[model samples]
Target: MANNQENTSEKKKSEKKSEKKADKKQPNKIAKWFKDLRIEFKKVVWPSKKTVINNTSVVLAVVAGAAILVGLLDTGFLALMRLIYQ
Candidate 1:
């Protein structure tokens, strides 16, 4: 009927308006996102291959030293505990 057609027409108009508004905002949103990404990427510190290798070696050495220390402590504690209990 005429009333149904009028309602649909109004709905379509409102939808078109909303779509246009969104279209207008899209560029600004995308521009800001890309700008932020660029700034963050610029602030990143890139390590050289040598630096990376040296850091990795230092970490591994520290981990091995700590492991050996903990193992020795565990063994010594067990021996002391056994002596005390006996």
Candidate 2:
């Protein structure tokens, strides 16, 4: 009878442990995602305002240059095609 009581208690303890593990496994995903996002954002190194503005200007300039180059190429190709068809 004592051994049966011990076995029942051991089974209950194991059941409690498994419950705890199951609870841990079912974490609130949204809370976990926000927690991970906060941790990652904390790790980021932000640039200075002047550096950001300078980089932004550089990007705009490059984009404008690329647009102009593409426009010129398209116009030249259109003119060449017109001459060939005429």
Candidate 3:
């Protein structure tokens, strides 16, 4: 029927219009995302230089302690293995 054809044609036209609108807004969406990211970055409270240095030194001390403990365990295991094989 003619009415059915007209309805289908209208639906297709509306869909095409929506697709075009979405395409046009794509760049705006990206720009809005970057703007939001900048705003959030401004809200962050960064650590002071002295605080950063203190934390870094603590981390290095812990890592060094762990490495020495592991090395001692490895040496003990090697001594045990040599005794067993001898």
Candidate of highest TM-score: 3
lDDT of 1 by residue, 16-83 (tens): 99999999999999999999999999999999999999999999999999999999999999999999
Candidate 2 vs candidate 3: the TM-score winner is 3
Q: RMSD for all candidates, in order, please.
A: 4.6, 5.0, 1.0
- Candidate 1, residue 37: lDDT: 100
Query: What's the ranking of the predictions by lDDT, best on top?
Result: 3, 1, 2
lDDT of 3 by residue, 1-86 (tens): 99999999999999999999999999999999999999999999999999999999999999999999999999999999999999
Candidate 3 stretches with Cα past 4 Å from truth are none
Q: After superposition, how far is residue 46 of candidate 3 from its true place, in Å?
A: 0.7
Worst 10 residues of 2 by lDDT: 22-31
Winner on lDDT (2 vs 3) = 3
Stretches of candidate 2 exceeding 4 Å from the true structure: 1-24, 28-33
lDDT against true structure, model 1: 0.99
* Tens-digit per-residue lDDT, 13-32, candidate 2: 99999999888867776679
